[model samples]
Target: MQRFRYRFDLTSLHFWIVIIIAIISQALKAASVVVPSSNCYVLDNSSRIVDFGSDLVVRFCKDVESRSQTGYVDFGRFDRFNHFVAGSGQVDFVQGFYNGDLVKCEHSYDKLGRTAQVNIICGTCPNGQCKVGVGCICNVTYESTCRVFVELAIQCEKPGPRVFKGFTVGFHPRTWEIVYDGMTQLGFERSHQEFSFATEQTHVYLYMTAIASLSTLVQKPIVKTFPDIGLEVRLSGSGAAGKPPTTLSPTALVVDWRCEKARDTPYEVNITIPVEGYEPIQFTLTKMCEFTQTQDGDATRGWAIFGVLSCIFIILSALFCCGGFIYKTRVQRQHGIDALPGMTILSACLETVSGAGQGYTRAEDINSAFANEASWERPVSAQGTRRQSERKYGAI
Candidate 1:
């Protein structure tokens, strides 16, 4: 009986190289993580208070005749000087001397609070009656002249008039204008008064407030309106308008107000800031909430990195295979085996088996050949004897 044996070359460097490359490919595929974030939009720039005015108007009374303790006297028409009054159902007015001339003023009432008011009466006594036994009567029409002047010296604080979370405000250095972010400007109004000034016979007191419009930054259009959110704004400076004297201080002033409710349609906020010695300012801010946000890794970059690694690995694998083949071929050549061109390792192995079979000789076949040699020698000797006997018989 013949025994068969087989051996595996587990120690081959080429075998282990292939296993290492496969493990590396898997590790690169499992590397990324997910993250979260919010979406937002910002106001492009700050809103500035370019120009402002206190609308002033003056009205004078004429055709005056009165009876005094000096008895009945006729005084020709003369203008009456009176102080400007505001917030009074009576005409808003101011009294002062301009250029050494007494100036009595009254302004048209603005629902927006843009002007001051003063009242004046003018007319004549009915039927020239200078006295209703004592008092005088007039049936005259009133006349008013309007004038305007600009005033400055105003400052507003954070979360002004209206406050909202995540909202911030600032001032521009160059323009000294109000700056804000994450909000949009809508419009403004001016209607609060601060103080009065007397200059060279001209008595001037400004009654005005500034308003600005703004809204929150919205990335997309709202499908529907949300509930209203309330906010507050507080302001304080050297001369703040529309505030009580008790509330006025050198320090900051705060006022709380509700933000216009959020809605599908846009809404405007009107801010009213008063001026005393500085430029008046006003603007509107709108709040909008309608958009989605998400956070994630850069998928493209991650995949690109992974792909690059995979390509490198593939190239390395090719190089390793090539190096192993070359090494094997060289070793086979050194051992005097003919290495065929373009022959793979498997083909070389099959050829080696075929050659081994052709070179194999059985021990039994060799012993049988040696046993047949003696029989082959007897045939030659017998042939020679028969030839000699045939020669003798022919001689007899």
Candidate 2:
């Protein structure tokens, strides 16, 4: 029994020793972890964190695998302008940095405080020897490569009135490209790619708050309609009129109240932001104003002038008809068609056409007028021959 107890005690001690060793191994592995996955990496060696305000922060780290010839890590040499200095064989990463070299660096919320990286930029080391902070280390050549710059992407849940604070350079994650804040995202670039920018406040706030500061600086109005309430408004692009924005800020915009034609009616404002390789961002905005607005100028004035002219013309026509009827019946003693104003004028026109320029005369006197003509007189001999012929006919 004593021999069996000694063996059991020995086995138990060995098992505890093995368990402690495994725990120590895991802790050491975590402390020096480098690249866990292709999409993510850690700055475990000689890391330096640079906080550029709340919008962006960069962590410059030495390559974990690099065996630095010098005792210290190389963060790369920078000029006064915060640009990387390149040797003869090395390419420039500052001038055309947006074309490439900008990697996505996202700081996630976790207990480990790990920042995941989507892409990596490697630079060839100057000498054949490897340096820790030059960039990602390459195995083929003892030389090292490093990530020179990083980018952060920010997207707004609701694009409200963004004021033009100034110009800024930012990156687009979907397009995997970098651009200026005012640069148009066209073609494949129109993907609702996030653009890095700073707001008036360091923390999240309500929308349209920037308009208050920009209102005093605005010189012109976007829409012609006069609203019952006037509030400062801003937008990403120019006004709805296609005119340029009043302020120098590219995002500074003027609210176009004329979005819908129907007035005094409630409606939803549908906004669509396209996203490539994914679903688009869509939301609706409700009007804040209580009353609807119409265009300026009294529309009824034009119609009023027209109505007055019409009434005057109608009254004059009635008066003319009444006066003509009374004169024809009482003063002229006319009857039948002649007593009617319209018929009298129509008959006069017909008489003028039938008389061929001769003045008006009775229809029965037409024959008398023809007999009095000089051309109607016959010769004396022709008249005597006609009388002899008549006497012969009578004798028969």
Q: Identify the candidate with maximal lDDT.
A: 2
For model 2, residues 214-240, the per-residue Cα lDDT tens digits are: 333323222212232342223333322
lDDT of 1 by residue, 1-396 (tens): 122222234445667878888776554222111110111111111222111123223233342323222443222112243222112222111233222121232222422112222221112233454433322323332233322221111211221112111222222112212222212222212111221111111111112111222211211111111223332223333223233221112112232222323234333333333222222233343333222112123577788899999889766765666677788778878988645432344343443434433333344433433344444557777756644543211133
lDDT of 2 at 299: 61
Q: What is the C-alpha RMSD of each candidate to the true structure, in Å?
A: 35.4, 24.6
List residue ranges in candidate 1 displaced over 4 A: 1-184, 187-297, 340-396
Location of the lowest summed lDDT over 10 successive residues in candidate 2: 201-210
Please report the candidate that would top TM-score against the real structure: 2
lDDT at 32, model 2: 16
